[model samples]
Target: MGYNTFHTEGDMEVEVEVEEADQSASSGMAKQAVVENVALANALVKDGGYSWTSPSSLKLYPIIMLITLNTAMNGYDGSLMSSMNAMPAFHDYFNVGKQGPATGLLFAIYTVGQLIGSLFAAPAADRLGRRFGMCSGAFFIVIGTIIQATSKDIGQFMGGRFLIGFGVTVGCTSGPIYVVEVSPPSMRGLFGGLYYSFGYCAGALVASWTCYGTGKMLGDWSWRIPVIIQAFPAAIIFCTVWLLPESPRWQIANGQREKARSFFVEYHGNGNEDSAIVNLQMEEIERETNYDKELANNRWWDYRPLFSTRDRCFRMYLLILVGVFNKFVGGAVISYYLPVILDNIGIKSANEQLLINALNVVFSSVASVFGCFYVDKFGRRNLYLWGALLTGLCYIPMNVIAALAEGHVAKGTGYAFVAFIYLYGIFFSFCWMPLQTLYPAEILPNDIRAQGFAFQELMNGLASFINTYATPIALQRIGWRTYTIFLVLHFIYLGMLWWSIVETKGRSLEELEEIFSDPHPVKKSLEKHKIVLATGQGVKRKPSSNVNDDGFGNGCLNPRNKESLEKHKIVLATGQQSKWE
Candidate 1:
């Protein structure tokens, strides 16, 4: 193997040769935190070396943004279809009604691809590595875009949509997990939320505007323009993803601890091997790496560990809710069929409908940005509850307005309905856009993250399929009454938001054990997090007080109450035979 070298703070800039870990690790040894001053742990982080604007952070953020943009692949597709609903040229060329089985199939086929693509999502993410999943997914989307844009017939168009769906699922399946894996623990919420808040919205923004710009044209180019535009984000990702680093946690899991340590030292520790920031991360990764061995015997294909316990079951419930709610609560309907919905309310000019859709994307993007930055500021549950309530309540007013405006150009009611839509869009994007992937990625154990997401995407694909297929049919048959279903979802989702969404703000990935292990996760998640930091040598520090200990203060990051060396005993016994490949 080729060697790369870096200094470890000697007098001279000595370049020590380090073996490159292009693949898995097999070492049985483990590293522990170095901080020995337990009392001085809380003050260890000086604002100086860990500046967010440091060169280390600058080099890191762009790679994350590139991988995260895979989300835009689907967002762009949705924008294209919704914009097409308002385009006469697309309907005329395709020879299909704006709201019927034909239109439903056209829109829903993308989700069919997602469902099928989901089958391989775990394999790609777990075995091939994040870069592989990202690069391959991007390739599929680009190819799918080519087929769809140049298609001569409906069958051709459907084939393209299927490929796009499959590609995006494979692509997106790794993105959130990878982003969360690499993000700074304190800023995990911000970076993770940006996966959708920025990437998905950026895709939506481009597509909506591209549609508006092309809709003014005279030929088949109007719809084809935006369809082709869907290729850009994935293309960019495909080209740049190989330059991205492998996840440090994945490196450790594979036993490349030295390589993982080097990354933490250079990027996270800022040339120092023992920065508090790097130490904390190493502490978390090492502990989780231990538990991951317990799961090593279970082949990558076995998913039983995801639901092997009651806590795991609650996590499964939360995953299902995130997946289903992402699409079912009227969001997907608005996303893919907004033009159709607007047409029903006397917004007759196709141009006017397209304009409204474009503006809504812009408006929602602003809310998404706000949500992204403040995700850690406002606890996940708080924002979700408020958004669910506000957006859900808007549906009732919208249903009432649509009911009053149907069959006649009641300009007043039509405008009122549009206003309500803007309201719903803003609030919905504020919470859901950021939380959809961020919450699930953080809650799931590293061992089962791929399996957990495989399950979540299944639920996501099912809900999306139901909405994409049923909404237009329901809208056509029942007119305004179709929204009543979402009103019901709104209520149920609001209750679940209050009961289920755990606040993960300011907690490390390994630290979340305290939250999930307690019977009352919501309550447990809310408590202030405590952790014992090691300087250079201690394996574990017994908490000074046992009566008030909540696991956070127990100097050990392990979920179990064992010293660090004891944990490595399990890894040593199983590490060699428990290979993923």
Candidate 2:
């Protein structure tokens, strides 16, 4: 075995060319993982570390892509359920009406299951590891999909929906966390955004088309087919997810230091063990991980650390803001209930509704992809502000048009409503959908990040439950007037977006800690200069905005471990894997 020594905490940057073909003494699962990772590193990471086409980067992308399916499954459910509601065969089979308590209970149960699952997702992610948590979630979905497809009664069908919902919460909670820890710091937004962006869109696209094809069927197969196919992504996740490398940060914090180091070397450094960028991140991970652990020694699992200081409590507030705003902004109204919404504005044909749903997903996907790429450039805070402004404003016109065109008075009204809905969908996809997982992953600290995601899922589930359960009844009772409520919500969301959201565009996981530490995190986060050290030196290139650093120009602004350097040691070994324990 060959490994390079990393002198990470220094002014001078060390760059070394690397070539490694190590196949250690290990056998079976562990050895297979090592060999596979080496192939992935050489094939994906070697050519250009930062480039999307780079060997290691390509290797990393597939991992992110697979995990994106977590969000895709949720999208699949939303689009599938909406299409099913429009299907005559489905309505006949289930004996459920479009607008009533029956649809509400069926839909609300999923969110209820998500709430229950949120309670366990954090512990699963933290204790068993991110990959395991994701896999466990996928496993439940596989079972749920089987049950849902084979359901002989409403009870069984609802039971399956609950399981699927629970599974989605768990997968969603951990998958984004894994992406954040593994993604390249500068491009974290793009990869993180992919979760609910193209991922969700892809799922929606498939489900809508599937429903359109099945809507022509004469029997229960119409709904069963879509429900059965829900297992496709979940099955893939359950079977293949373990083959991917675990989060290196998770490994380091949990005492698998050698494996963590190898991941950084192979994946992050393209097999160059001494990669400066990789080492800096590893050092920071070790530093903060230990400090957080020590800080919690006084009282374990009391939940005090989250509210231990003003800064942390502020982070909590941000978490709540993100969690609640994501669902409350009325995206749920479009997601699961769009078919019914279309009916109010005079488009009653099931086929047309399914087709429009498919197209809407496609256009929204385009918007999400655009947002995913430009997110780091425009910044999270700016996107939220603009996205809120546009999407919020869209609701006013939508409400006016819906009210005027109630019962499909004219073709022009229907066309106009579609156009407004498209704009609303496009703008929401451009902003909130992409950031739903990305922003929370960035803002939450490592210690509470997993639980924070669970909290996010809880808030998301609660809000979505309220929306899904109330939408049908409200649409039936208030007619076109239901649009007024979400319109009002968009206004409140816009105000909150302007007030509290912070810019997480150009910073690393550790760098965000300092920003949050400031009295005004939003103000500090908006500053151009940050300490990510994402590029320059031996890496691809420096951040375009100049860095504010500690005179050495290497950006060691907050020199950590100055006091505990002697007390806490990171044992490094040459020619062999170094396990921290």
TM-score for all models, in order of appearance: 0.85, 0.84
What clash pairs does model 2 have? 44-54, 44-55, 44-56, 45-55, 45-56, 536-541, 536-542
Residue-wise lDDT of candidate 1 within 1-581, one digit each (tens)?
A: 22222211111111112332221223322212222222122312221224566666777788777876888886787777888889999888889888888899888898889898888888888887877888888999999999999999999999999999999998988888899988767567888999878888888889899899999999999888888888888988888888888888878877888888887777666677656567667777787778768766447667778878788899999898777875777887788888888788887898989999999999998999788987866768888889889988998998787777678867777888888888899998897789878999999888778778878887788888888889999999988788888888898989877888888776678767656877777876664312222122222323333311222244335454332211111110110111111
Instruction: Write model 2 residue lDDT over 335-414, tens digit each, in one string.
Output: 77888888877888988988888888888888987889778667788888888889888889888987897654586788
Regions of model 1 farther than 4 Å from truth = 1-49, 529-556, 561-581
RMSD over all Cα atoms, model 2: 10.7
lDDT of 1 at 95: 91
Per-model RMSD to reference: 10.9, 10.7
Clashing pairs in 1: 25-254, 25-255, 34-534, 34-535, 34-536, 35-534, 35-535, 35-536, 36-535
Per-residue error (Å), model 1, residue 382: 0.8
**Which candidate number would show the highest TM-score if scored against the true structure?**
1
TM-score for candidate 2: 0.84
